[model samples]
Target chain A: MPLPKDETLIFFSKPDNALVKAICGRLIPGSPEDPGAVEAGAHQYIDHALAGYYHSQRTAYRRGLTAINAYSQSQYQKEFVELSNDQQDSVLTDMQKGTATGFESPKAPDFFNTLFQHVREGTFCDPAYHGNQNLVGWKMIGFDGAQVAHFDSHMQVGADQSERTPILTLADMEELNFPAPENGY
Target chain B: MSLPKVDVVIVGCGAAGGVMAKELSTNGMKVVALDRGDFLRTRDVAQLDELRWQTRGELQEPMIKDTQVRWRPDEKTDTIGLPFLMASGIGGSTRHYTTQHWRMLPHHFKQYSENVARYGASAIPVGTGLVDWPMTYEDLAPFYDKVDEEIGISGKAGNINGTIQAGGNPFEGPRSKEYPMPPLLQSTVSRLAKPVLESLGYNPFPGPSSIATENYKGRPACTYCSFCTSYYCFIGSKGSTNVTVLPVGISSGNLEIRPNVRVIKINKDSGGGETTGVSYIDATGKEQEQPASLVILSSYTYENIRLLLYSDINKNGMVGKYFMDHHYPFVWGYFDDTVTNPSTGPWAANVAIDNFNGDNFDHTGLGFIEGGVLEALGGDLQAIAGAGVGSWAVPMPDDTPSFGEGYKQALKKYFRRIASFISQVPSLPYDANYCDLDPVVKDQIGMPVLRITYNAYENEIKACAFMQNKAENILKEMGVAKMKKAGLFTPPTTTHEVGGVRMGTDPTKSVLNKYLQSWELPNLFVVGGAVFPTYFGYNPTHTIEALAYWSADYIKTQCKPGGSLTQYF
Candidate 1:
């Protein structure tokens, strides 16, 4: 019942945070109509994953962050979060089309593709590693928390699919606002 | 450095190594068994967690230490196929495997010749290095029974005394004995699908699992924690060599096991002719020399061949050739109607329908001789199994929200409404798809690891796609609301790597003879999966154990009560 590390926090400047919000909005966009990543808590969840549990993705993560920074610098002549929503959308589209400023670099295209994919994965993966904050992603995808088996009457054909319940969520824990150690080390 | 001389030097302590250690030691021969990994006791395994190992692949062969084999055209220049992936710790891959054992079907021995006669040689995939096994299924039957009895297999008899049964595999080779224990309990998932399977006319029998259902011999019954395959059983319920063989082997003082010793060379005479001993780098990187009258390469499939090729021993220079691995493509279904608990027990649930396994069905007209076993395994909920789901209910086609009121309701409705049906197809060896030495990329000790070069031929692809379709039909017949075939099938590579130093009658054609002895070097024997000429529909643990017993029995008769090494030469 303890809080995560401060380094794990992904509170970007308005410009950069706005860019992330825009990208995540396209990936899963909460409520389909509003299409916002904040509602999914995807940015916060991604920050947590970046700080921990995504060790295998370090190279891709670094490259991706660099690519986004370069795109904002070239296209808007400013940071990504500072750009307007339309401007952010244009930069992302250009990057995906392999025409962004640094996309010509040997590893730039790869870096951009990997970054967007990781962001999407982070937003949607299980909440065990701190992504999908507040069960937003799970609730969106209809996933229950680490259930043992669901092969019961739920697995039958034409059986009533209602009355199903998730195993548990972090919200269910009584000790929610737990304190964190200054340094686990 | 001081040199110690023993009668035999066994290269590993897993399934084959354990058996060789017991056989030679019990026969009054001094045996020195060396393992590259540490000795993990019950205490090491007793602390089980779903997070630390299962989801993280702590038990699997790593891409860093154990590289997967690659396929390339140029043999000398291309470094792609070298360094096949395999487990390195004590008990080797057996420590982490699911332990579903089955002998290669009877026709597997004569597959090449039989297929040629029926389907014609053109039907066989070109470049495939398929060959008749040097020995017949009948020859390995007694040994298989011995291994089954020793390991305490928990399977219901499929064919007792050569009589075909309705539920068991009708295509399995004759067995001298029955399984030591009864099969594990069937899950609710299996029960719900069984009736539909029968109505569709498929033979579903209890899958042969190594997990103990009841107290067998000295081992306890399975606790059904659902953390298997990648996790070791803490209760000694899983029939790994650590629990079944190594214990008894160690009790007899003749078996001297040295863990953390990485064998670097099969030390030959200065002339580089006959093997005299083995030189290994210990855990501290200190070199130690152990001399022996005989050496047994009982390592994993690729490791055994790698060690031999590094030593430059095979007279014909056919050290690494004919590597094979199975093609597994899963078929999954999401049921709109609920029936059973999705997660309940051990790794595999229910039984297998072996109608298409081996030559069970008509192969005379089919393009491929063997097919696969279509079945479902109870899903293990360890971290790897979660695989990113947020909603609990089926998403409406128009639904686009991931988080909000609609999303929460959806997440609550469909979390456990999924089931998977799978296919286990047979893989054959090919000429281009073989194991060989890589000139570059040496291991820590400067010895080249065995490189695997493999590509599934058209026949294999066809067989896999066919089996996948069959699996889909079975799922549909089971009345699943929505079923999807698991696709984007990548090539396979891992612990079950087989063939390379295949067994055959002619020394010019194979490395090992019928008795599992190197035709060129009679005193040196090779055990483990490398001797298998073809892959079966099931896991390789049981067959490897059977071969180990067969090799051990042969070694005891030919090399024991020793008069002289001159007779072998």
Candidate 2:
């Protein structure tokens, strides 16, 4: 249920769009044996949020992405997505520490915090929001999602309920006759 | 447009307003209660969407459409936007509250006199506007019992007529009887913490909750859905005003609830000595006048302050001074063997150790004058909320990576293994921590927003550190492998914000009288936590309800058909 290409391209340009994907991948880069933000469709989630819930932050994203590119070019003489993994991490580290130059208005640390929070939300939120595809994020964190009832037996002290049952989501709740939200507020 | 005059017109039909509407209408007084938000049906809360209700605050007043408040830690710094943690609809914050209803200890009401007597007058902090409440706990106890019975609060009474009871909060103020309902079932975290607290000789008891444990008043018991905090209960188990008081008020046939209207000002006489009615804008942007013989302001703390300031009703310049909130600090424990099951029960303090709260323990040499309650809580297991450092139950430690494979592994490992103890510390009022109209910000309707100037004082910070140490000790005694102390020095977070239009015996130092009546304007009665003289360790909802009932009774007897207000004064 990822956003269509036409809708995804509305929030960011092609180059900045690829840069978001690259940043999310580095923030939660999973191994070949495990799932991460990339597998959870965090980039698509960010795109969806930018077009809706986080629409007010569009200006900050644009300014922050441009400043990040400028800082990358000055440091590595290349675009952020084109840099090596280590180089990209270094540039992001600078931004996180608020030491990256050329960032104004939104500032570097503020932008980093915003992007970090969005990436986390995209990774962990219910898949009905078009993220957490296949419940990868939930599996990664051992979170048994959306148990409407029957948690008493599993939630006992010293109980190992982690491997007790199959995980559920908001989508499953709809099928199980449990009330789910019809629309976002 | 002009509406027909009623006997009483109450603005903001939430906790206090709900009680007022019920009492006045049932007593045969025609009442009109206006609320800015809709009276949501139970179906509206049937869905369990943590992302929508908890994280995004869908049930709360939207900052974009509502008045967005501003805040700065200190007066010298530039103010930043802060969310007013209040709900707007029929129930106000009571709709989405955790329902951790608690009656304030007797010592809380007499903090000023008690501290002065114990440690002498010079022990009082220089800038702290510490004062005894106009009324005592004894004066409000009957009303407290009334609210507990009417709202069906569940708890074991600790003190009954000065006799200490077993397996209950022994430090509690004397009560005539037990709670209306039994306490909610204990969670795994509470079970684990009980032995540890008892070993330390701290009296551990079940926290009083407004959520029903058994069928009461035709409403079903709590389902223990874990969506208890920050989300409405679909089963009508939580004793919110919408489910309990408002319905009774409407059933009386004398109460008229007008929703989706904003009261802009409390209209007064030409001489500005008494309130005549109120001017408001309807949902369709039409200005209307709702004239009444008596006007009661029962909105949240911020709104009560804002309306008073907006109406230019600060005759003694004490309209929005001494704003306070319980400066909450959390201590978390990571146990490898124990499954704390942080997402199980009513999502409130299930078990609390009251030995350290209020004046229960001596504050003799402790630099601070007040202390706070320590408790084991549950149901903050939402994923997105737990990902952040300061916002989570088991937050990422300083050494842990912000994200990556390591972060994912840590989250999985500690998801059910982490338990936290939150310290609900008492906050004394300070002259510097006050609220005024923001010069730069305005609401969606072009009204100036409230700007809060507050910071953690030395007393509060020291109390927080002391409580954190105590929490850490308890966690260690519980055999926690790893522990982290999180003492927050941020903006006012606890929803127990109090003391804006504070009540006092002296008119020069207060806005409301002992009966919560406006000193300058006799017909205007202000209710809610806004009239609290000081913030206590416990939640303010029960106290607020009791005060509202007390004020309603005062209005019932003193302002009835032949009763005279002059006689009371």
Candidate 3:
């Protein structure tokens, strides 16, 4: 369910998208054995969410991204994306602990928490939402996406099931469909 | 628009309303059941998208202005998080319920008397509004069986007409008949805990659930689809009233179900001694009057109290008093060697032990009066939650850092190897915990929203902690590598919302009578969990369904012309 790569950005600007990618990389670092948020295309997922289900968070994302960059500039005279891996962790820790400066409205902690939540959602959500690219999230952790029934074989699972078998989504099942105008955020 | 009058106008056609609708309509009385949501068919609930259904509380009562429920820890504090538990569909919360159908034990009906009889007069907690039920378990036992057949329950009866049956909850009240359907397959959680439970000399039987194991009344059997709770049944297997009694009421040709209709005012006679009917907003959003001889309020607990309070029917300032809810303390752990694959069966496919619940064990010197049923849970699988998306219930192993590589590695390790257990303990109704209208907040429809002032008390906290210890003991015996006991007792958040419009014999002390009939107005009846004076440790749906059938019989046989139904009548 990966979106076509050639498609234009729906919500994020090129710079914002790059910033989100860097943040996603730090939130969950990508690895060969177990791909994390960056490898799962969580930035794209957040962008798509900002365009649709989470349009209200647009200002928060904008200001929060700006604040992260501003704080990075102030602390190290560089953009957040240019920070070293260890430096990036320290910056994010400050943001998570509400210690990072110049963040308002969604303060440092609020922005960091919201960003982390969206990152997790993007990393682990159904690929029908256009995240979890190649079902890497489902594969890294053994989650059978959408099973019609759970038999004894499912309970006997020792390794990641998504790695061994095909993962099901809403598109795979004729019975399931997204009922929209999803309220109650 | 003025609609045609009916014999009964039932507000909130859900768990109790469905049964009442089926019963009264079948008895040849015309019934109109109005709800604020759609009559979603089985096909409407096919999807299991975790983000929408679980995290968003999609099937829950939508957080519109009119459907708002505000909460605070106490009267002085500001309202905190919005507590959304009830649903709006034809089946209400029954649609998304885990279907753990359990009949309250015999002693649960006599909470006050049993404690006094066993441990003298001081056993009852101070300021607790504990009282003996005006009606007995035997009185509702027949109706409980009727509910068993009506909703197609799957269970093994522990006690049948005073004789104890093997493999069933031995502490349960005597039942007149066996369940209509047999129990589902024991889950991996159940299988893992079965020998351990027996070694501890506890009776381990598969819990009773409305889910059918064999096709009955044309509903299919459960598929172990994992989307059982917090999601509706797509295949008509779960005995949601939409597939059960509600259809019977419709097919009987005497029931008229109006969805998306909000009942605003339970109309009363000018004298304030009789119910005329109800004034409501129709499906098209026009205010209308539907006059009837009787009005039944089955709109869950909060709204039931809200409507009565708004209608100025607070007889003893008791309409919104004595609100209570069940205390659910969850205990879970991660295993190193075993992959318990906690994601296979529905929640009902687990075993239940009543040795700790109700008056089964000695509560003589304990800090609490009553205990709860502790069960090793099964198939409480949520992909988003298990994957660590939602903050409500992220399944990271105990002591693992919540972020970075340690978080990812811990979640991956425990995703398939976790074991979870829970206990459902009933919180005693205290004088301080109650529901009233929110003066500051109003719904879009110009009605005052329900403001609940509740706090988890010592009795509930102690009971929950005790059960958490017991569950941890069982998990430790099962040999878990790492374990976590959830912080205990946050009230009015979890489901099992009961009380508020309590039933008692003394008209001065309670809102409704034993038969769920309004004490002041003979023609007005309030059904559902709102009438539970105090809930037992069991899930309240079984009792709610039983009371509906019990009241429906009274409405049919005695609550009519010339049978001393009421002096006014």
Candidate 4:
């Protein structure tokens, strides 16, 4: 599935956008055989969340992105997005260990923690939120998404029933004839 | 606008209020219950969206938009805004709870005396205000049976009238009879670990759950959909107040639930000895007064304390004292040979070993005053919430890379190969651990927000370490290929918070009397986990429900129109 084009950037600036894309590339990098956070529309998920549920972190992201660029310029004489993948990984490792310099209000480790959590959520959360596009993350992790799972025979110890069931999503529940509650909320 | 006076006006239609409404209204007394959030419908949670329900605060109250809770380790430190584990709707936190219903063991009620008898006087920690509950487990056993049957709990009774039974918690307090229904089907993790636990000389049984095993009381049985905790039961099998007692209360005709109405203050009589009514802001943004002959405070622990402190009804300043929570420690194991399909059963701990809980095991030389129950849980391995640091269901070992190719490979390999164990360590009440009204911050309704002053005591920290070691041993005995011990730390989050407005036989140290009625204000009653004297290793929902019923029975029998408060006093 393709990424949604209707999403407008709410929090990330031009430089921050490039930085986020680079970060997603290393955090959940895709190869010819596997899908990653970029393929799951993680950037779009963060972009849409900033306008609503995660609006409180807007200032922190702004400050953290600025510090990352400053650290990148000092170390590599280039912007964060302009660095090689190995260099970007090194910078992220420093931030993760809380040893990165040029961070002020929102600490470097705190920013990394928040960004990493959001990336995970974007990759694995249901597709209703515009993330997990086409359920790539679920497929990668072998999660049969949101089925009315009643496993009487497969619940025995040492049973490997993973291959028996097909993955289902919220959109497919109706066609699959999953039972809905009598009184709707 | 002013509402007509009723027999009783209850605040916060959650666990306690739901029970009180049903009991009082069924007994033909008029009741008006107020809740701050909307009475959510079944369709409001039709989709099992992990991001909205589990990862985000969909079922919980929004800290920024509704109330602000500040927390500080001690009195000398500055407080920061913290998110409390509570919900605001009509059914409250029970709507999203994992439904691990537990009755407090007999010793939990008389801990002060039992500890002294078992370990002598010095065993009682110095500053910990450990006291015996006003009522004993025997006195509340009938009520426990009532709630278990009424709410459709499923479990195997360990002991029935002094006879020990097999395949059950042998340490449990003796019940008058067996459970209303058989236990839920055991998960693969529990089934695999049963023989191992038995070989280690521990009793393992299916944990008591409020989730239905078979269709009873017009609700469907559990579907084992793996979306049990932190999400509404789409099948209406989990026994939340919304699906169980609240509907009965509403059908009684005498009970009126006013949703989206925030009670700001409780109005007192001119002499300040009794409550007359309560003032609230309705959903239309208008101030409304609801007058009643009796008032019951049945909100969550933090709010119950906040409401009492906000209204200045805590005559001796003891309302917000002695706050406690169960300090939780989790351990996970990865098995290469066993396919622990964790996503195919109820999300709660499916089986539990209670041999170490409460005072069942000898704590004579353990250096810790208490121990916790260890259990093998299932179906909580959600995609989004499990991808964080120290998450219980995350299968990544300590040495694994957090992200990239290695992380991807690890996720796929361990996703279905992991099983988790948790220990609910009991937290004792200390003078330093308490709740109070924030002096500076206010909620959206302009009322002073609740502030918590707490840190894990020596007993709790020691207990957590002890339980973690035990958990690791059990996982090793189960022959897991790789084991990971999630180290113990005191986080500000707890779903099982108890004891703010405590009950005691003596009025000097407690806010409520033996019957959960106010010591000073005889007509006022405070129900819920707020009346607990100390935290127990077990989940407090069953005890909370039982206490609510016990208090309602007292109100019904002793505090009638022509009855006198002398018997209670």
Lowest summed-lDDT stretch of 10 residues in model 2 chain B? Answer: B389-398
Q: What stretches of model 1 exceed 4 Å from their correct place?
A: A1-60, A72-185, B46-51, B61-63, B66-68, B73-85, B116-127, B271-273, B339-342, B381-383, B388-415, B443-446, B486-490, B562-569
Q: DockQ for each candidate?
A: 0.11, 0.33, 0.33, 0.52
Better of 2 and 3 by TM-score: 3
Clashing pairs in 3: none
Clashing pairs in 2: none
Among incorrect, acceptable, medium and high, the docking class of model 1 is incorrect
lDDT of 3 by residue, B124-159 (tens): 778889998889988999899899998889999998
lDDT at position B193, candidate 4: 85
Candidate 1 lDDT for residue B515: 74
Better of 1 and 4 by TM-score: 4
Best model per DockQ: 4
Give the C-alpha miss distance for residue B380 in model 1, angstroms: 2.0
Which run of 10 residues does model 1 chain B get worst, by summed lDDT?
B389-398
Candidate 2 has a DockQ of 0.33
Task: Evaluate model 3: give its TM-score.
Answer: 0.94
Q: Give a tens-digit lDDT track for model 4, residues A58-115.
A: 8988889899989989999999999998899989889989899999778899998888
Off by over 4 Å in 3: A1-7, A156-164, A175-185, B61-65, B390-392, B559-561, B564-569
Assess candidate 4 and give its lDDT. Answer: 0.81
Could you tell me which residue pairs clash in candidate 4? A184-B43, A185-B41, A185-B42, A185-B43, A185-B44
